[model samples]
Target: MRALTVAEPGRLELQQRPDLLATGELALIAPRVVGVCGTDLDIIDGTIDPAFVSYPLVLGHEFAGTLLSPTAELAAGTRVVVEGIVPCGVCAECLRGDTNRCAVYDEFGFIRDGAAADLLQAPPHLIHALSENVSWESAALVEPAAVVWRALTRARPQAGARVLVVGDGTVALLAGILVRQFKPAQVVMLGARSDQAELATRFGIDLFTTDADAAGSGYDLVVEAAGAAAATAAALAAPTRGGVVLLLGYPGAEKVGLPVDDLVNGDITIIGSFAYTRAAWHEVVELLNSGALDLTGLVTHRFALSSFEDAVATLRHSSGARGKILLDL
Candidate 1:
């Protein structure tokens, strides 16, 4: 099998690996598409928390694949998207339906080999079938979409509320797109890059601004996806009194000052959403299956697996409107 791997921090190579086979509870899969995100870059650059990642790891957590073996009702060659977080079902958190916070910490593309390869070995219970209507590229995004879905569901913005999404990255763009289902009166995006206006507009964002101060405040709901300390602060201030602010970005190990007094006095509800739970993943899959979410035009870039270097470079130095970047197998 050909796999793209970060052999160590700051090192990446596409090399041949031993054939992976399904054994016991595992199932073999041929990854059809893989989506690379900022987390992947952090993995390659060794900037992610040391406790979460292991060396010589394959670099894909967002992907779609074809099942190589039939399991239960699913047929062989079925299109599928496997859950990245492998939860220990018996754990206390898992039992409570908070699988994202499972006591056992194991996830694909992190502690285990990911799907940035010709073939993947996944647990059968974690795999979910995709309807034929869903595009392979769209299916590849299920993981991240599920992440955004979880965050948005947590905040539960009221119907006709004003929503503000901070950041121009794929995550932020997705947040703006998904919040629409909640029937927000307006969805405004605060991005750092002026070039992202077109992409944000395409996602149906009502307004896009690069300036946080001029972007206004008192939003009914605010989402922070820029993964920066300043953006986090902007998200805090953007929400109205008694409104909700959701933190979906990862700003690394650095700590940022928070307005603790304002949070208490303003009766603000702040939530830090992590990975998706089993229920959140199911909701996203249902939305995609029913065609309620049109993921079209969201994938603005594509690269061959062999051109992983170019893909990584583009991610680091992208200038204009950028959406999901996929590595096609």
Candidate 2:
């Protein structure tokens, strides 16, 4: 089997490896589609926290695959998505249903080999079978969608609330799309790329602009997904009095300045969300199964496993309305 391996920081290659076999309660999965994001770059560059990643690792955490063998109630040929974060169910945090913070930092594409390969090994408990109607491309997005879902759930936006999403990337776009589930009064996207206007519109955003200041403030809910220090400051200033600001982006390790006076005087609430919880993942799966969410249009690019270099290049140099880019394994 051939897999994309990051031998170390600033190094990536397609390496031939032995086929993975299902052992114990784990399932042998044949990966079909994998989604790459900005975080993957951090993993490749060794910029992410050392505690969360291991070197010589596989580079995909968001992916969907076909079950190569029957596992428990699931039959062979079942399409499925697995949770990347592996939690120790006996831990205190896990007992409280906060599995994302379960003390164990183990995860696929981090501590273990990821799904950017011909074969992947995942525990059965973490696998959720996709319904027949769901497309493989959409299934590949469950991981990122779950991350946004958890953040929105934590923010708890009220009905008819005005929403503002900052960033043109997939995470930011997904946040704009998912916020519609709460029936917001209006949803506007503040992005940097002029080419992303069409992509933002496809996500049901009627108003998409490059100027954040022109988008105006007074948003009931503001999401910062650009992952930049300037974007972080803009997010804090965009909210109205008593508005909720959700930080869904990664601003690296730098300390970003905040408007303490505005936060205190405006009664603003800023929430910093990490990864998705087990419950959040399940909810996203249910939404897909129920046909309440349609993500098929989100896929804008595709490539074969052999075209790994091209795929990475596209992700870095996207010039148009780019959405999710998938690796067809």
- In angstroms, the error of model 2 at 179 is 0.6
* Candidate 2 structure quality by residue, lDDT tens digits, 206-309: 69998977889999999999998888888999999999999988877767898999999999999999989999999999999999987888989999999988
Cα TM-score per model = 0.97, 0.98
Predicted candidate 1 versus true structure: per-residue lDDT over 1-329, tens digit per residue: 99999999999999898999878889999999999999899999998888889898998999999999898868999999999999999999999999999998899999999999999999888899999899987798899999999999999999999999999998999999999989999999999998899999987999999988778999999999999988998898888899999999987766788899888888999999998999999999899999998786788889999999999998999877899999999
What is the C-alpha local distance difference test score of each model? 0.92, 0.91
Report the CA-based lDDT of candidate 2 relative to the real structure: 0.91
- Model 2 misplacement above 4 A: none
In TM-score terms, candidate 2 sits at 0.98
The TM-score obtained by model 1 is 0.97
Q: Give the top-scoring candidate (lDDT).
A: 1
Give lDDT: candidate 1, residue 168. 91
lDDT at 253, model 2 = 74
